[model samples]
Target: MNADFPFRIVGFDLDGTLLDTSGDLAAAVNHALTSVGRPALSVEEVRPMIGGGARHMLAQGMAATGGCTEGELDVLQRRLLDYYAANIADKTQPFPGCLAALDNLTGRGVRLAVVTNKLEHLAREVLDALHLTSRFDAIIGGDTMGPGRGKPAPDPVLAMVQRCGGGSAAFVGDSVYDVQSAQAAGLPVVACSFGFLQQPVETLGAEAVIDHYDELIPTLVRLGSAA
Candidate 1:
């Protein structure tokens, strides 16, 4: 939406965008539920509830179990977090072309960062597991730098840009939350159709919607050339 900025720094959403981590996340959620004598959620049921944050995911999981009281939800959330922490990398992995895309972007001199609602420690673990920890110039997690606002608020994305020297940046992600955050930050948004978007990716009002990471390099190149 912000054509004046064009593109320089590229920020990414972690969970569903770069990594297909539903398998492990769902497993952790179910593990927590089982520990508390609750039922487990199927992978499909847990996938859509992701991207918001761990509390949201835990709330959804508890809701699926016929609603827990406020205190109960808090207890469940803590247990789920502990379980998730222990199994963060069980079956989690980067989506196809994610690493290649990061490599290509870095090779082409694109400044990169990650802005996500995931917790910093868990996010770091995922990136480290994929050996991608060094690829990003910055990683702004949900709980990083205190409990600032989360996605759907521009704070995280804007913070990433500010930390990366505040040049032209593009936010790349899979959901409406990412689009909204980018817009709020006055950055152009790029939606990836291949990620876990709850609705059609086109509805996010991004500057462009790409289905593959390989398409990203040429798109940014075209934007740079145009600028």
Candidate 2:
């Protein structure tokens, strides 16, 4: 580890960074589509839409179904949320090497936390289902932290730092929103190459882009040293 690096806490985005929840999310989207008399989206078709919140996913599903009026979309969004909540952990799992990477960090005395745009209940359900609830020192979801505090804003990441006892921190995520949030929080960020990045990961201005969880420790060490 780089002795000069000031980081003590590492905040991760749940869905794309640590867990591969695309399968479950796609299933829920298709369920909503079927309920609304629309065609189901294939797994590949829904992968790119996974990082955003349920509203964004529902909006994309609506567009795919030829666009609904705002009121109609609201109904569909509610239904989609219900359906997704019912199936929250049907197929969710940690990405390859995620548990090992987290374990290494924990063993080395680094605090770990999750800051996600996902609904708090669902996020906790997925983590519990994957037996990962015990791994985090803190978990902040979009709904639990009150309004005016989601991704693309520094509130959630900053809150995570405060919850972890307030120290230097890093945020790991896969989207421009995460990059922006980390920047706003004045935290170094590591972007995941395999997450649902809508644009090139390099364009997000992350300190490093990691293709695998196994690279996390070494990258952190390198970044910490540089810092």
Candidate 3:
């Protein structure tokens, strides 16, 4: 282990923070929208609707195109998930410098983990497709904790620490849900400015913000040093 590195473990949120999944996600949302005669939304229009789970994202899309009954939303959500699973990696790639940043952490002997609001199976599928599943010591998904216990609930974040065998840890993410979950788990969080932001990245209340993956190591080092 690198004694100079203060953090022994680091957890990441998958979608926007680790990978740019907007293309496939937007396609899935559009598929559901057009299936019921709703107008298709542009990728830019659908970007902010991500971070939340597929059902929540689809609901926002449904509302944007045209309001839907709960029943319709239920049906459309399944379709969205099914479509997304099949095309999860079509346009998804790690953000610039993401792989390098992860490698730096791993080289320092920092245990890496993924704590995402995405379902376990889907998260696994996407990571496996990208050949990234081997990098993380733990992969905790929204469903891994059970119904109603996803991010913003702190359950998954806590589970990440446990699964990683416990250590001084920190989180990196791109959403309010990520900040809340990490904070609630008593870890400092760094926000990604280039992520799928529903609001200003500064307003997410993370301890620090980085515009690119190249800044990740420095940011985490500063955060750890300050701690």
Look at candidate 3 and give me any clashing residue pairs.
none
lDDT of 1 by residue, 59-157 (tens): 888888877788877887888888888778889888888888887666666678998888988899888877888888899888885675888888889
Model 2 / residue 130 / CA error / Å: 1.1
Cα-based TM-score, every candidate:
0.91, 0.95, 0.99
Per-residue lDDT for 33-117 in model 2, tens only?
Answer: 8887899988888877776688888788879778878887788778888888888888888888998999888877789999888
Which ten-residue region of model 1 has the weakest summed lDDT? 1-10
The TM-score measured for candidate 1 stands at: 0.91
> For candidate 3, lDDT tens digit of each residue in 7-62?
98999999899999999999999989999999999999999998878888998999
Instruction: Give the candidates in order of lDDT, highest first.
Output: 3, 2, 1
Score each candidate by Cα lDDT.
0.83, 0.86, 0.93
Lowest summed lDDT window (length 10), candidate 3:
50-59
- Which candidate, 2 or 3, would have the higher lDDT against the true structure? 3
What residue pairs clash in candidate 1, if any at all? Answer: none
lDDT of 2: 0.86
Better of 1 and 3 by lDDT: 3
Residue 102 deviation, candidate 1, in Å? 0.9
